[model samples]
Target: MRLRRARTIAAWALLIGSIIGWPVAAFGPARHEPQFVLGLSFLALIVESASLLTASQVHEETGSK
Candidate 1:
C-alpha cells in the first residue's frame, strides 16, 4: 500500500513538474535553468521505470495474470 501511494504521488509530481517546469524553462526568467528541468525529467524517467519493475515483481509474486 505504501509503495502504491508513493508511486501515485511520484506520478502526479512528475506530471505537475513538467507542466510548470517547461514554461519556466522556456519563457520565464529561469530560461537558463533548462538543464535543471531536463535533469529532473531524466530522474523521473528512471523512477517510473523502477516503479514498473517493482509492479512486475509484485504481480509475479501474487501469481496474477
Candidate 2:
C-alpha cells in the first residue's frame, strides 16, 4: 500500500515535471533539438505507464466486493 502511494506520488511529480520541463528543455530560449523533446516525451510516457500500473494494483487491492 505504501509502495503504491509512493509510486503514485512520484508518478504525479514526474508527470507534472515533464509537462512543465518539456517546453523549457526543448523549446525554451536555449532552443534545444527536436530529439531532446522526443526523448523527454518518451520518458514521460514510461513514467505514466508505471504510474497507471501501480494505481491499478492499488485499486485491485482495495476494490469493493
Candidate 3:
C-alpha cells in the first residue's frame, strides 16, 4: 500500500512537472538557449515514462482488467 501510494505521488509530480515544464522551456525565457530547451524536453520525456510506469502499476494493483 505504501509503495503504491509513493509511486502514485511520484507519478503525479512527474506528470505535472512535465506538463508545466514543456511550455516554459519552449516559450519562456529559457527558449533563448537551445540546450536548455532540449534538456528540459528530455527531462520531460523521462518524467512521462516514469509516470506511465507507475500508473500502469497502480492500474494492475487495482485490477482494472
Predicted model with the maximum TM-score = 3
Candidate 3 residue lDDT tens string, 1-65 = 66666666667676777767777767787777787657867686866768676776766589644
Q: Which has the higher lDDT value, candidate number 1 or candidate number 2?
A: 2
Q: In what order do the candidates fall by lDDT, top score first?
A: 3, 2, 1
| lDDT per model vs. reference | 0.61, 0.66, 0.70
Write model 2 residue lDDT over 1-65, tens digit each, in one string: 66656666776666677666755666665465666667767586767766775785577577533
What's each prediction's TM-score?
0.44, 0.51, 0.54
Model 2 bad stretches (over 4 Å): 35-65
TM-score: the better of candidates 1 and 2? 2
Ordered by TM-score, highest first, the candidates read 3, 2, 1
Candidate 3 has which clashing residue pairs, if any?
none
Least well predicted 10-residue stretch by lDDT in candidate 3: 56-65
RMSD of 3: 4.2
Q: Please count the clashing residue pairs in each candidate, in the order shown.
A: 0, 0, 0
Query: In candidate 1, how many Å is residue 61 off?
Result: 17
Comparing 2 with 3 on TM-score, the higher-scoring candidate is 3
